[model samples]
Target: MAQQKVKRLPDADVEAIFGAFAAAEPEPKGELDYVNPFTLLVAVVLSAQATDAGVNKATKLLFQLADTPKKMVALGPAEIEDKIKTIGLFRNKAKNVFALSQQLIERFDSKVPESREALETLPGVGRKTANVVLNIAFKQPTIAVDTHLFRVANRTGLAPGDNPLKVEQGLLKIVPDQYLLHAHHWLILHGRYICKARKPDCWRCIISEWCRFEPKTPAPKGS
Candidate 1:
């Protein structure tokens, strides 16, 4: 089978696309709701390959029972699994959630680590999860590319690349410093709502003019 050619977007156009996206959704935020950094980390772990709504639904009750790392660890893996069984990979995720909470309580003095290296050392945490926690929890400037972002970057020609890492690097280089703080949330919201995977709402897209995607998807008829 022949490999598909990857698209390349102009830097200026990429900037404009993000600019318009930023203008439209000035203050975007993650869908996951948490009371603290520890809960945010746990929520992100449970969210892998799962919808935020689903995670929130599970966590809404779970967090109330075990919001802190110590409390979560005390809740145990089996208990965690029961609470988050609705999510995909709940068995493994439950194990990691319990183990990670124990690690936090024992290693980090019951606090979510601020550094990326420290954060990723936890059982369930990956680069993307660490980035989300670092940015949202610690207020650090980090972009964690998920499936939605990877697709949006390539589809919109915003930061076209073969993989999430390349797109992440591209965003890091081009994203305006002023917007860096909230860039992740903005891109995620755009990818989630506007520049979708199967079909993009090109007509209603505020950044359509800046997009480099050839033959953009047309607006739905009679809408």
Candidate 2:
């Protein structure tokens, strides 16, 4: 099927949309919880194909057991798997978690690298994970186009693209500087809770006025 032509929102509309987002959530935050950059990195890796709540549930004990790279390596892949067994692809994720921990110690001296390039070198840490770490942990103005953010970006015509990388680039180019830092978290939240994949909740959306999605989703039967 041919893709619908996405209407590009004007810069003025985009500014107002972000203004609404900022007013609604002055301090947006990622759902994943972590003690530090290393733990945040691990949480992001575990979040692939899984929900934030799921990752947090598994990481509660895992982080306690090994928040640091050295400690994580000491915990071993087997134990890592055991701890994160609740998450999908636990075995592979465990291996990645352990291997990445080892890399952090060997290559970066046990500290999570601040640069996205260095972060991507770690096992299971891809562009999305690196962007998440860069934005959340290091406070870099990087946008991580996760499933949620991708939907919001494209659906709203704030920055439409076929793939995540394209969407990421589009957002980075147009997002206002003042709102850039929190833009990622805001878009993710908007998509996850408002512009859902199945049916976007346009009725209660904060930026519905500026969104480009047509035939906005109507309110359900019950108020």
Candidate 3:
């Protein structure tokens, strides 16, 4: 038998879905810990293949010592690696952090850039990272498609795409303007906790009604 095809949701359903999310959590926040835009950028860069919890554990002390570009540059990659060695690819992440910090100081006067193009110019700053920085740090209405967001977008048929950029553009075109600013956070959180990759807990999902995922996961036996 052929698998059920995922269908794109209607505009009204999308509105209702995000409306539910907004009503449930009016102000969703990213889990990564950060003291400032600079720290947030560094944290995201470190989170490439790492969990937010893991990143937070390392950054707790690391941020205290070097939360600024100047301070991070002073720390050096070797010392930085020592701080975040618990994470995967710590050595490379440390180098990127150090190099980007230096670039920030040399080019942007130690301030995190507002434009996506400028942010992407830094080492280890890709489209997703740049979008994240723009949205969270600079308050731009950009969606940064991480793994969670990517899965949720496809699974829910909210903005299905073969790649992150396509889904991001689709979402930007579909999501209402009022919800665009926080859509990244909302979708990411939902996918992380409820719309899980293995088995989405649709029973408790706030927006499950509007979601188009076939055969929604039922509550476990005798809950």
Q: In candidate 1, which residue ranges exceed 4 Å CA deviation?
A: 1-8
Model 2 — which ten-residue stretch has the worst lDDT? 1-10
Number of backbone-clashing residue pairs for each candidate, in the order shown:
0, 0, 0
CA shift of 8, model 3, Å? 1.5
Q: Rate the local accuracy (lDDT) of all candidates.
A: 0.85, 0.91, 0.93
- Please provide, for model 1 over 1-223, each residue's C-alpha lDDT reduced to its tens digit, 9 standing for 90 to 100: 1112445567777667667767777778899989999999999999999999999999998999999988998899899999999999999999999999999989999999999999999998999999999999999999999987877777666677888899899888878787888888887887788777667777877877876655677877888
Q: Residues 98-210, candidate 3, lDDT per residue (tens digit)?
A: 99999999999999999999999999999999999899988999999998998888888889888899999999999999999999999999989998888889999998888
**Cα RMSD (Å) between model 3 and the true structure?**
1.8
Best first by lDDT, ranked:
3, 2, 1
The local distance difference test score of model 1 is 0.85
What lDDT score goes with residue 75 in model 1? 90
Q: Estimate each model's TM-score.
A: 0.94, 0.97, 0.97
lDDT of 2 by residue, 1-223 (tens): 1224587799999999999999999999999989999999999999999999999999999999999999999999999999999999999999999999989889999999999888888899999999999999989999998888888888889988999999999998899999999999999998888888888889999899998788888988988
Q: Is candidate 1 or candidate 3 better by lDDT?
A: 3
